[model samples]
Target: MTTISTVDATKFKHVSYLWDDAKAAALAGDEVALFIYRSNMLGADLRLTNYGGGNTSVKLKDVDPLTGQETDIMWIKGSGGDIGTLKKSGCAALYVDRLRSLENVYRGIEFEDEMVALFNHCIFDLDSKAPSIDTPLHGFLPFAHIDHLHPDAAIAIAAAKDGQKITEELFNGEIGWVGWQRPGFDLGLQLRACLEEAAAKGIKLRGIMLGSHGLFTWGDTAYESYINTLEVIEKCAEYLESNYGKSRPVFGGAKIDSLPEADRKLQAAKVAPILRGFCSSERQMIGHFTDDVRVLEFINSNDLEKLAPLGTSCPDHFLRTKISPLVLELAPSEDLSDVAGIKAKLTPAFEAYRAMYTEYYNTCKHDNSPAMRDPNPVVILYPGVGMFTFAKDKTTARLASEYYINAVNVMKGAEAVSEYTSLPRQEAFDIEYWLLEEAKLQRMPKPKALSGRVALVTGSAGGIGKAIAKKFAEEGACVIINDINEERLDGAKAEFVQIFGKDAVASTLLNVTDAASTEQALDNACLAFGGVDIVINNAGISISKSIADHSLEEWDRLYDILVKGQFIVSKAGIEVMRKQGFGGDIVNIVSKNAVVAGPNNPGYGSAKAAQAHLTRLMAAELGADKIRVNTVNPDAVISDSNIWAGGWAEGRAKAYGITVAELPAYYAKRTLLNEIILPVDIANACFAFVGGLLGKSTGNALNVDGGVAMGFYR
Candidate 1:
């Protein structure tokens, strides 16, 4: 057993409280605000605790309506609150006596709904937030302040095989212990009983350690309880350090050489997009990577199978990480960078993972028979390649990754002290299938229109291109903006930041007419965001000339920008998308003039005609690969656009026998709907194709000339 020999207080943080901050909080007028501030200080350190893993409570005087007397009421961290970013409204208040009275009735009640019904009735103010599920424990303890957390260092001791014995030694007889029991009414009663027994012995306890769970500390002020938590956790950390904390062997049993650091990252990069595409569900998959040495040690070990079946260190992790991570095996011939090789291994591995998950779910869910969710792996492991976690969104993916990082650390620490341990598999199942947790999942916000997808928009510096790029980004797609205009491209990047934030937008200069330049630009898009799933081929330039007057050079230049540009970008984009094995879109912004003939526009119309025919040809050939190629023929957009800013619009207005300012109304009145075709209107038309609204219809031209009679399909 491990025992703490001396109290060296200097090892812990000493600045959670300052007089100036406390006074300012008080003077600023809200007491709950003060708790929020203090809670953040405690949660700021991951070594101390994680978001939603701890609760803090403060007791304050309030008038009891029935008795007309002042009594103490409790304000504790609410169930939905994150201590790291708690607000004044995030605290839940409950009457002390009212909460304690339910403990007996709660003792046998294991269902969250039943307890929640009772808690709702007992809310101190009736208008405050719902109290935490651990409310009973905090309420029964007759303390002015209480803080409960599962700090990594402290729980490292609590999760060991001889956790209770080690905790006794670490506390040096200064703390009380409660035996292992699932939290709820029974555990609360047990903690209260232990306190009563300690009082009978004339020993005033400052803290209590719950075996295989966490720790609790209470005091006269927020600062007292907070500091007590820090000191006790430090003692446990020191105890572990003195024992077997140095140079611990990790990575369950297998031994494999970790790839060179640079190779490791490159491998991750190669497989990340494939992993993203393997998800068969409508909800897109987003990936997160971990390379911490402890994680590396565990994944690289030969005995991965031996460690995986033990389950998570805490049941709370079941909500984010599930029970255990799925392990992926690498073969001798399959290198991470080889697209076909990576996919060959992952394709079967993915199917096997889902099959195993399905078996686990069916075995555990005989009675409830709830609708089964898609069997997607939250955590995936490859021994030498590293660990990758997948989630429906970036935030959830990051959370699952962080939890596993902490998990390996805690598991490692417990292994050093004794045999590492986790709660029973059935216990984890209970938490994972808990109705309350299920309800939380049901309440998760709907995925955004373009969630977990990426789009590349060329010619996106201004006008129609910028509108399309902004639209894609607004719908939650990661966007790569490309344009030939460098200054305007930089300007678009800044404006996009104001609209979409920096993470969603990546900008690069693209010369669409040059095959090599276009290939590099599209490749940049894949690197910027895993892979490109949407390609908007909107880049073009126009030249006005009659057939006889058009010189060979002018005709060549016009075709290069209008027809060949679309081909070059689309070709490169499809290479990446096809390797990804995910169906994608290529939206060619052809003009209405492609189908309608006009005077003095022979070169421009001919190039547009060629691009339109090219779209149908590609769609026919690539449909087998699941790629949908479509064209939107927008007639005339009258808003501020590069083509119309000076040269093209002025010349077109003169051709129409109207002033530049009157040309919009001239074009608008000519259309059936008599509507102005703004750049956004064209963008909306293009977005329709990209967003899958035209799912079953592709290889077709949708004329966006406000119902042109001549352009309508016969």
Candidate 2:
């Protein structure tokens, strides 16, 4: 049998005691502010709890809006709020008296769900957000301040087979225990009964270890409660460390060695898109890949087959990662470089996982249960590589991976001391399909048009390219902004990070005319966001010269950047999109000159005409793969334009027999609509083509030239 070694005490000791007396004193009179401070402190550490997994509360006397009298009110972390980023507005304030009175209406365990709806009537503040199901758990407790957390170390003890005995020995009766039950009115009642039973025996209970659930700690003051929570978790860690001193191997030692770091990442990049496609069987999913040492150790271990099948013990872990991960059925000595072989093996494994999930749903479902959700696995484990998680967006996918890492920690701790246990299959099903949980899922806002998609925009450091990238980011697509200019690319990246967050944007220096540079850029996109679904071929250069004056060098440079650039980028990007096994979009940023004939513009106009025709040719060829190719032609977009800034404005003015300052007016006057074109106008046209509105239409060009008569498709 495989066995685990003791935990390093130093690992737990690293969770610092960060409470500052001066900071606490600064908010002495405001109990809610104090509560927020305490919550923030605990949530700032993932060792304490995973993101959005814990709840905290402070019972205080506040003026009741309806009665105009001071009454006891409980302010608890509300539904769908993270304690780490919590605000006063994120809390649910409820009347304690009204909450306690609900015990009279509580029928039994079967009807506990009914209590959730009644909680709205107990609202002390009309503006309060809806209460989480855990509200009753906090409100029923008598403590002035309370915290319920799913710390990895604490859940380790809670998930162990001998958890009750370990709890008694470690806390010496200070912390009590309750059997596993789903969080609701019934479990809240169980908690109160456990505390009362301990008190009747003359035991001073400081906290309670929930069976296969989490830990609860409370105190008369906010700081005291924070300290209590920390103390209990630290004690649990110390106990585990003492029982099993680091002497034996973790997870029964490694069955297979991990690949080299670079090789592992390459393997991950190669397989991520295939895994993403399978996981997105129900709906499109964004992907996150991690080669964290902890994950690699577990997946490479002999106990992986034994432990991973049991699933995660914590609700937060399983809810995000699903009951169990889909483990690839590959041999320890198998070569990972064969991506096609891996794909062939994954297809059957994926189907089996789906079958298993369907069986789980059908066996455990009840009449009132929400319909079965996507049966595809959220987490996929590769032995030599690491972990891959997919979700509706990048952040969620990343969070799922983090939660699974937490689960790995819990499993290590539990197995080190005693046998590890997971929540029963039926219980897991009930929680996953709970009506309240389904309602919460339904309450989520509709996803933006470009949600879950990743886009790569060339020449995105400024002007039309940047505008298009920004618009894609606004619609919830992760964007990789590219340009040959390092300074402008960095500036644009920083600006995007500030507005859309770092996770939503990435930047790379790309010379689209070079095949190797284009391939490397696409590879960077795959590493950053799994794969690229939208390719914007917007990079260009201009040379305004007549047939007699045009130099061969200048003509070749124009075609190299304007025509061949789009072809190279499209070719490389299509390879990635094909590997992803999903359809994608390719938008060519051609010019109005592609259709309109003009003098002194032979080099620029001819190259653009080639780009326009290339769009149609690729659209026709790639339609079998479901990749759409389209064109957006804009005329005289002088604002923030790289081409205009690079002397194209002066050349155009000279051609039109006008001053350089009159170029914008000159171009607008020649248009049928006489409207000045802007970068955002071009961006909107790009969005219209790929934003699902024109999803069925492709191999077409929409001119954004304010209706130039000569540029019209005749």
Candidate 3:
């Protein structure tokens, strides 16, 4: 038996006090100003934590000088305040004793009510901000100064399958693992129960593991607790790096030599987008586990389900990695870059996973059923092709991928210990089918502009194309979304119905540039929803060209799609919009070049001009027919929208002589209103023009350009 000795206090006692000069100064200042400073500090460190990933609090010890009676006047981190840019109001001050008392009767209580009760018992002289979900977790720690962190290394270790054992070895007997569960008061209650049990058993439990969630460490002093927590995580990371952190293996589970060169190159290109998609969401965890042997092995594994044993790392991760990866058995004659074929192969697998997940949920409970999550894996690691993460939002997708990477390593280590003791299938089913989580999955908190409307967006495959299509879908509109990128198109198809329900969505892969293809796509839309009401002419591309140096063929090709393609689709859609009787919307997505002159944009600008004028002419003709036509002129929407163009970060960087870091002000300041418009911003405008609000608006060009082109607007 190994008996641990208390270390010399000197080694861990570098700074016993919680607040140093800087922190104290900030805390002493006006509450609002202090919060702002704290928030910025928190924002700067990816490891200390990411936004909403952790919590912090200050215990105001109030003492009557005459009586010497001291009481804890609590100021806790507010619910939803990003610690990096914390505000004074961001911290909710609840009476410490009331919070402790609430814990005694908090079983099965609703989360929101529990929070309200905490706010009601406030003692601090500050506006009551809703307390953080981890308020109870904060309350559980009996400290004057407390802080919690979801440090990258902490998550990286927590993601491991044998997390408890690894955490024990790294943090030793000083830490406790609370198993996996949802966050909020329930988690707080769980942690308290564990602490009470430890006390009864004559065992001391300090830090805690919230299972797949993160970690919590507290102390009487802020700096002491913060550094101690950091040290514990750094040590755990060091431990893993020393032992189980093996060399990242090359992707060699399958023979890529059989694949064609073009296909291989395509797959290589696809790898970055998938990886980027994952990392983009959680930038704080940059380069943490981009390449891991277990991740690679799991990607290459025949039994891929083992990689995602207990579903996604959390809800945000689910958005990126989806439900599972698509496993493909490369045939002798198959071409790897046969993008369409690869998509076809994966479709059935995705459907199968969906079916299995649905069945698992249905069978687990005889009393109630929950809505199903999107039938997609947030972390899809495609063997030799590497991995891809998907999410409705960029930040979440990246975090999901990180979680997946961490989870894969943990599972690998745990398997080495024994068959990894995963939650039972029934338990897994219960989580997957949890009613509250299901509600979040099914409910949209706010109504979308195009809600209840049906739209058909052509070229809804990838980049700007997919963003627009998704924008419409997100606004509660059932979309007949089309795209040439069949794999992505199909993936979106599966997700749209999963998110919006089967009755609200339909998808097909068709090239809008082809007249016949446009006609067929329009027909599909009409067939799916009984009629098509809104048509977003988003199927266009740019050829980097100057008229002086560009070939005639390239110039003609740009016109073929940009101008001619819009004509074909809009013409076809008008027939359906008329038949539907409800006045329809036609939004021609044109570039800033249509109004603002720029060099080397001859083809793109000219084609867009034609489309813009066509919009006016169509509006004039379609107006009496009760159909509205408008132009959505957007200035450089920073996204994967512009084809193989570098990407949002690159474009913003190039435009302002700075990296994506300086882009908020750099891009925004350039605009008259200093607005850096996003794709969603443009989509909402388009929805307005097409929906009831703009039913009376027509024949006008709406600049969704964030005041970048004021002169052209009038």
Tell me, by lDDT, which candidate is best.
2
Give Cα-based local distance difference scores for all models. 0.75, 0.88, 0.60
lDDT of 3 by residue, 259-321 (tens): 243443344333322232222222211111133444556665544544454554433333234
TM-score winner between candidates 2 and 3: 2
lDDT of 1 by residue, 333-423 (tens): 2455577877886788778877877787777774764566668778877677677787765556667877777677677678777877887
Q: Report the C-alpha displacement of residue 391, candidate 1, in angstroms.
A: 1.9
Stretches of candidate 2 above 4 Å error?
1-12, 65-68, 242-247, 330-342
Model 3 lowest lDDT segment of ten = 280-289
Q: Model 2, range 1-714, lDDT digits (tens) per residue?
A: 111122232444836566777898899999999999999988999999989998999999988777799999999999888888889999999999999999999999899888999999999878898899999899888999999999888888999999999899888889899988889998888899999999899998999999888999998888788777877898887776775536567888889888888777776776777787788778888888888998988999889999998998888888898989988776534564565677787889989999999999999999989989999998888898888888899898889999999999888888888889998999999888888889889989999999999999999999999999999999999999999999989999999999999789988889988998887777677767788899999988877878898889999999999888988999988887877777899999999999989989999998999999999999999998899999999999989888886677777888889999888888889888899999999999999998998888779999999988888897
Q: In every candidate, how many clashes are there?
A: 7, 0, 31
Over 4 Å off in model 3, which ranges?
A: 1-51, 62-70, 103-126, 151-172, 180-206, 210-213, 245-265, 268-298, 301-305, 309-343, 365-370, 409-714
